[model samples]
Target: MAKGLKKTVVLVGMMGAGKTAVGKAIAQILNVPFLDSDAEIELAADRTIAEIFERDGEPFFRTKESQVIERLLNDERCILSTGGGAYMRADNREMILEKGVAVWLKVDLNILWQRVRHRNTRPLLQTANPYETLRDLAQTREPMYAKAEIVVEAEPGLSVEQMAQKVVDALVAHGGIVKDT
Candidate 1:
């Protein structure tokens, strides 16, 4: 962790855990650019995530996702917010860890359900039993998410700003901002 190396702050967590919102706040505080992988994918594909999944399928969307993430990792400084499923893939997780410090925006399942239930765009939650699907996804991803360099709890009652500050504080505490290699 040298002082000259580009520092990247990457946020990973379940859907609706406020990664995009918090990543923006962190970027503003750190005076760096914020990049959301999902948004980048949408921009590159010229379609929404739901449309990509529906028209091309999950595999296609994931390929695009990995590509976007790889490009972003080349940056020297950025606050990156990844899709919920991104870290579940081995290569994605390894690339993030190698290129930057990853922060897990942890949120409880109940809170996640409340935030995501009405969003039909979430392919995994589009099942007839969304609750069960969410529960399963959360369970499966929690361990992987926990492997992040830092973990910040996204409490239901806390404002996005508060969570953002918490992430920054955690980054500072964990020696996340390092010099270039």
Candidate 2:
């Protein structure tokens, strides 16, 4: 495991960008805690994200997501994986920027589509034409994602561990965020 992380690493991107999986691997390698804002929300609400969306609404879900993200950012230095839409809100983005290192995982639409197509868990993609919805969401969000301090491309066919290592390498090479204890 690696050590001596100066700040929390917040993983942000689309739903299928592997934020949770890669964040878990990165946290394990860094010997830091892994926090998923979605999981936290689910635990707190006693319901799945989809259920929450169905019950209250997207506005309610976004509010809860922001709250959970703020709470998580205030916690110990760790790897935090946020819901795909978390960073879209300015308040949430500000909180993440203030409290953690935001790394946007950039993946192509086809790759993202492939990863998310089979899964019916995405609230936003629960549309009549999910593929087009995803594409449109990606287009709208790419500019905001580009505002992140670091950008790590998601290569097709890479294992989760490799993707995590790639993020580590990006941190070391670009910002020196992680170092030997």
Candidate 3:
């Protein structure tokens, strides 16, 4: 239940890690709202993330991202899904850790590639040889992601609902963040 958590469950991970989907499932199971920072940004800007990246650049998007993340984390406790790059910033990471329990949804590189390769919506993967780009991004960002208070490993065949349950189970197991009662 939502009452089990003292703070929001901030889901952080790579693009294909199913943060949004799993966050939705978690929120449903917990009886709380699911807030997505990227979606909030899109709603505020009246444009898609790819469009924002194309027009204003990533630095600008990231500035808005930090703003949205802070706002979302500041709101009522919920399952908050953040963009893949949100945890890459120290300030955002600090804010997340301060306001919510950060859960890193760690997925395998091959599984990540499989999940994201066909999606044109991801701006970061729009480079030449996206597989290599995703690998590079993962290698660059994983150490920071590893700093999350909770790390939930993702399996290749698990459904979104199952992953959400795994995340909630991990939270309960973590003790201080989520109470079993």
On TM-score, the leading prediction is 2
Clash pairs detected, candidate 3:
none
Pairwise TM-score winner, candidates 2 and 3: 2
- Write the residue-wise lDDT of candidate 3 on 29-115 in tens digits: 877788999999999999999999999999999999999999888888888999999999999999998999899999999999988
Candidate 1 Cα lDDT to native:
0.86
- Residue 117 lDDT in candidate 1: 93
| Candidate 2 vs. true structure, TM-score | 0.96
Worst 10 residues of 2 by lDDT: 172-181
Those runs of model 2 whose alpha carbons end farther than 4 Å from true positions after fitting are none
Off by over 4 Å in 3: 1-4, 179-181
Higher-TM-score candidate among 1 and 2?
Answer: 2
Which pairs clash (backbone N, Cα, C closer than 3 Å) in model 2? none
**Per-residue lDDT of candidate 2, residues 1-181 (tens digit):** 4586778899999999999999999988888899999999999999999999999999999999999999888888889999989889999888888888899999999999999999988889889999999999999999999988999998879999999999999888876578688
lDDT of 1 by residue, 128-173 (tens): 8999999999999999999997888877688888988888778777
Worst ten-residue run, lDDT, model 3?
172-181
